[model samples]
Target: MGTTTEAENKPAESARRQKTRERLMDAAFEVFSEVGIHAATVEMITERADFTRGAFYSNFDTKEELFLALAERGYNERLELLRASVANIDVIMPTLLEQNPGSLTATELGPIVASFLEQQGDNRLWFLFQSELRLLAMRDPEVGKLFLQQKHAADQEFGNIIAAAFTAVGITPAIESVELAIVLMNTYEASLQEAIMAGGEKVQERAHELFMQRMLGLISQLAS
Candidate 1:
């Protein structure tokens, strides 16, 4: 066999680095969710990831950077869910119309919208991580600025998705798409927090039910 050239090694090295980074992020997410950012440490994350402190440092300058990366990852995941839901509208809308053959009402539309916004990850863990980020943002101006930037970016993307969904269904939003997106997101978060606070065996199910109820009401008021 010929000696391995540096050029040939680059791709494998890059893949290994990416794998290491992802594992570190996964460990950090769990540790941060269990303990707030202020309480969580690099050692805790590296220990959970089964890596050394050097590995953590090589991937991230500080825990704050990793925290922000996690936030971005969460936003991207939600955006992907929204995109996937919207992409399936041709299939989904026909089925909805077949079941109820008329102009779609809030009752018909609410579930479609909810399906797009639903989280694919552990809801409680995501909520906890978000709560921690919010607390940190409130305490540190730099973090707050960065967090708001990410939130704004996510809002814009979600707004576009919402606009597309409404257009697909032939509904005119009473408010700006971004404004409506913000309201829906806040409502979903509130519903989730309420369900989590109540603490039961079916927290996710309860949250979805509560969101559907609230969403139908909001849709009725916001769409024509």
Candidate 2:
């Protein structure tokens, strides 16, 4: 078979190509986690992926391209988790209030706040990614633009939820809710990166607890 025909006839070719790409992406993720975004390279990624240089090039044009792709994938995935999570928001609140009110400022707001912090832990990888993107924002306009677009979308989504919560309570929602959500999203994304640098996961729990108490306490105060 000719080159095109040969590539087409192999039943496993499609799967192989996809599998190879995933390997590279996974490799890049590991390398970035270790040496960070600026230091990670195609060679390091390919080494971890156990693929040839040619294979890596075939799949991704450059390390930056791969990083950007991985970052986008991470963001989309976390968004799905957050969107799905709030579906159970009502039920989760009561469970949180019942189980761990002492950990928060008040029992009534524990669930939503705790749940968000938990999801924040789950989304730590993407959170690391935003840290890199922020550093590159002014230096690299394209990456900055993509990063900002995602951030704005997340902020708006959180703002919408806050607004709905206020409307439900028969109060005109404050503008600060939108601003707070934006700050909350940005701060959390940046904060996780700091926590990642401070030894390990132990710090994460502590940070989450403090953030939950503070932010949720503020929210409860506003709602009241």
Candidate 3:
């Protein structure tokens, strides 16, 4: 029988470590969402992930670290979605222009923007987790600093996507891309919160509609 070489084992070991880290993050997301970060404990996360305490410690030094990691993951996921949405605009705009053959108005742009910005996964859970992070940042300076850094990076990336989308549609933004990204994100979050509060069978649908309407108006007012 051949013995396993360290070189061969290295890839397997790395894969295992990555899998562990992903599981822990997934579990932490749920726990943190259900109970605020302050209330969430390592044991709770471990139990949710069905891992030992040692596993959690091996993956993360502290809950705050895991929280930041989760935030980063969420931001990356959203950015990917935004990128995909922007890419679709390249395909969409030509057909739209062929049909209309003139400058596209807010009415024409609203659905595209809304489709890209539409909430994915569980909105209420995501909103709760996001709200918890914001509150924690307000109270904890260290976490706030880290959170802001991550948020700024995400905003910049999203801003690039926005810029790309504007270019695709031959529209010049009146304001900076980052500022526009921030405004649009804030508006989406506010609309989501309201929809969640409204409490109904179609909260996500309503949220999308509300955001699309607000976005159309903002686009009209903000774009030249």
Against the correct fold, how does model 3 do in TM-score? Answer: 0.87
Arrange candidates, best lDDT first. 1, 3, 2
Q: Which consecutive 10 residues in model 2 have the weakest lDDT in total? A: 101-110
For residues 49-139, what per-residue lDDT tens digits would candidate 3 score against the true structure?
A: 9999999999899998999889889878877877776767656556775775446775676665555666356777778898999998999
Output the number of the TM-score-best candidate. Answer: 1
If scored against the real structure, what TM-score would every candidate get?
A: 0.91, 0.77, 0.87
Better of 1 and 3 by TM-score: 1
1-224 in candidate 1: lDDT tens per residue? 89999999999999999999999999999999998898999999999999999999999999999999999898788778767766776665678757655467766778877766674667878989999999999999998998898889888878877777777776777889899889988998899999999998888889899999898768887788
Please state the error at residue 22 of candidate 2 in Å. 1.7
- Which candidate leads the pack in lDDT? 1
What residue runs in model 1 are displaced by over 4 Å at the alpha carbon? 92-94, 100-102
Give the clash count for model 1.
Answer: 0
Note the residue pairs that clash in candidate 1.
none
Candidate 2's C-alpha lDDT?
0.65
Q: Is candidate 1 or 2 superior in lDDT?
A: 1
